[model samples]
Target: MAAVKGCQFSASLSGSCYVMRPRLHRFSVKVPFFDGPLRSRLVSLCCHNPNPDSFIVDQTVPLSKNPTHLPDDCPQASASSPSSAIDFLTLCHRLKTTKRKGWINHGIKGPESIADHMYRMALMALIAGDLPGVNRERCIKIAIVHDIAEAIVGDITPSDGVPKAEKSRLEQAALNEMCEILGGGIRAEELKELWEEYENNSSLEANLVKDFDKVEMILQALEYETEHGKVLDEFYLSTAGKIQTEIGKSWAAEIHARRSSRLKNKLN
Candidate 1:
């Protein structure tokens, strides 16, 4: 056996044979007993013990023609290939171009796009104070994905004359299409789950993100009112008493106080 070290061996037993090649760190055994056109199979054996007498087979890996090649079905290998990633990002360009219909309807010049709204909501989630039973990171993720479907649906608003159920259906279908565009791997599945969670208000993070959505809207409204010198009373009225979380209520109150002070200053 010592003389056979670092050498190949071929032996026939019961009409079957194996070829063994020994190496320093690993070795491979080729067996040719299969009953198909595939005449030989390679089994890789990892060498753990330094001493040959105490050699132990640590792992056995079956290899195809190329030893380092991964199968086509490997998840990590196929997840978000470059082409698919580019395609998905190209589809998302609409989010950056499509302005929020609410702002556009108000005749505001150069309104924020759907991506701008979601980005501010994400920032709101990021800067929010810690709350018990709330996952801040998940809140950020939820905020980012909350309006992602608008990339396809183009930010459908109540004034669009579409029913609530119909709007939801359109958004859901758009999200599914977006996921498919991303090639449907772990990340795609996660995006779908987060979007659904926000849509259904299924968790504390979802609740907090929902509040951030309203808070972001009202905050934007206040900024628009100050910038455009137009009192957006309807925006404030719609969000009044609708904030769910304590943080959201406090933020909304502060915005309202600031708006009131601005109005008084204008009067004087």
Candidate 2:
């Protein structure tokens, strides 16, 4: 059994209440019984166990407080409110409208949007073969969020001359603001964590998602090369030998094979 320390027990006409504070979150436990104060005392005695791990704590507690009000320049919405959803979705509209800078710079017509790239990555994650100890669902979620900050920061490519650290800082700030607009609930916290995981390459899921990112780019480059009859060796060279996961390497190899075949046929 888990021991709970510093639990405050109180009696009420309807039931008994106990408040438990864990390492990072708080839990409110209530028990209703027809008995009187004696039952409440007995329950409190049981709560005094010395093993902390015996008691299961709910992790659904909100990590941060939602803003009670919006700023003067923003729409009026509270965290977890309907208006907040609308406002956040409105902001996300930029993702669908902003074209990827790489394609634009290459003189490709009708380039894919950032959201379009993320959606395909998510689909890649969905259809990925099962790997031992890897969380496919987490990979899918990471894929969706990996480029979400681009909605505000735009696509900062290598040619943009922005320092890597500066690009990360800008994206982090944008992600934080987006989460704040989302009303700072569990979902918002999740988005922040997923984005951080991908940014840091901290987990297997993050590793896979990163590979998917490169694979997606190279695949797009191949498609554009075929459509526009332009050689995009830089894209392929940039991603060469950088895929960390076996699945990513396999997918990239297949795309490379197809591109090679296409180039050979072009010579004929």
Candidate 3:
């Protein structure tokens, strides 16, 4: 059996090799499975198998002589394109945190937007949660929108002594508003859950993201001080020391010392 007209399956399964061995012209045809040189094989087959009775093919109809047609609807109908793109920019626009571009005016680089932070925290959680009993993907998703309420309430950076009840009221109102923000789609509901999960920090995933949230802010504060001056934010240090996990405590110490040194250099 040999392939004919780029139909390798046909050749191997039933037909014979159609190539003249010397004539090697490149030909291509779009078939689901079979592939080979079609024009070269066909011409060779026709030339060599000149006898009409030998090579068993329906010679009355030439495969190459068919005309292709576009349906009438093809010209008039619109093409279906993908839905809107969800890049960092669009995510930023949706988040109120980045509404003030001045917040990112500093030299800190990782997450230029709140969405960027969520996206990366999710990534970090995925990468870090190799420990037993942790659902990495769920944790990643939990991180992606943990601060969605912040998108509405605005960042309450610990310095603002807004009473706990007041902040809770504002943040809860914002959270409730988010239920309707995207019209209660699965995505919006999932984001709302992320906020709840983070706030509760009951599950291992939530706890991991909680750590990441603190870590991200500390990193941002360090970045801000680097650009501005020694100026370590007092709020960050106070919260950092209270973190129970030694993993977090160690990270705080490292950042605190690092920022303190930066502050010293600036003071000079």
Q: Find the candidate with the highest TM-score and give its number.
A: 2
Please give the range of 10 consecutive residues that has the lowest summed lDDT in model 1: 10-19
**Clashes within 3 Å, all models in order:** 0, 6, 6
Give per-model TM-scores: 0.72, 0.74, 0.53
Shift in Å, residue 180, candidate 1 = 0.8
Residues 1-268, model 1: lDDT tens digits = 1222454332332222222333555443333333355333332233334445433444333433223232233222246878889999998888999999899889889989988989999999888999998889999999889988988889888888999899999999999999898987657877888999999999999988888888888889989988998777888888878889999999999988998998999999
Q: Each candidate: what lDDT?
A: 0.74, 0.77, 0.54
- Each candidate: RMSD to true structure? 9.7, 9.9, 15.6
Candidate 3 lDDT, 46-161, residue by residue in tens: 32332333333323222233211111122111222223223322433666336323243433444356666677677667667276787888877787667667666666654577
Put the candidates in TM-score order, highest first: 2, 1, 3
Candidate 1 TM-score to native: 0.72
Best by lDDT: 2
**In terms of TM-score, how similar is model 3 to the real structure?**
0.53
Q: What CA RMSD would candidate 1 show?
A: 9.7
Return whichever of 2 and 3 wins on TM-score: 2
Task: Summarize candidate 2's per-residue lDDT along 41-71 as a digit string, tens digits.
Answer: 1122234333454344322212124322212
- Please give the lDDT score at residue 26 for candidate 3: 44
